[model samples]
Target: MTTMNLPIISSCSVDGCSYNHDHDCHAGAITVTDAAGAACGTYVDASDKGGVDASGRVGACHRSDCTHNDHLECTASGVEVGAGADRADCLTFAPA
Candidate 1:
């Protein structure tokens, strides 16, 4: 099988986000989309107590308007997750 070159989630500072592990994102990958701001569509509230054990990676993105997205994949080497208008957001997102 061919492997995909998904971007890694470098860091996340949203303490209440389920995918965050010691300031790092633990989801396999994340999708970024436009909400009130550049939001992390993969972000789940830790109150729900759900998350993956592996390090986070950027799988698919819906922000087709973002400059860093190509074919729904993030081209950035890495991404940062942090608080936004809603909750967790992709800090590397840039509008195209």
Candidate 2:
């Protein structure tokens, strides 16, 4: 997994959700889902601004051994985005 020194927001937008710990996204695998869970939030339109919404709509895997993961954040440079079967939800998720 690559390493990202980027600083993400201190809290998640999900209401009543408690996955963040001291501004560190420790959700293991953050899940990004629409209100209806119909599609992954990471699926960006090619025409979207900035290429994608790296902060608001992407998912990440915090698993210690995942090659594509890095401390709960995506280290693919500007591709802080990820896709998932459940609305781009974090596949390596863990309850707070």
Candidate 1: C-alpha lDDT: 0.79
Over 4 Å off, model 1: 1-4, 48-50
Residue pairs whose backbone atoms clash in candidate 2: 29-90, 29-92, 30-90, 31-89, 31-90, 32-89
- lDDT per residue (tens digit) for residues 1-96 in model 2: 322354343334222233322322333333333323223233332322332223332244344343444565544332222234432334433333
Model 2 — TM-score against the truth? 0.25
Candidate 2 global lDDT: 0.34
lDDT, candidate 1, 1-96, per-residue tens: 112468888888888887777887877767787676778888887566455776788877788888998877788888888877667888888889
Highest TM-score scorer: 1
Lowest-scoring 10 consecutive residues by lDDT in candidate 1? 1-10
CA lDDT of each prediction against the hidden true structure: 0.79, 0.34
TM per model? 0.84, 0.25
- Stretches off by above 4 angstroms in model 2 are 1-60, 71-73, 80-83, 89-96
| Clashing pairs in model 1, backbone N/Cα/C closer than 3 A | 28-57, 29-57
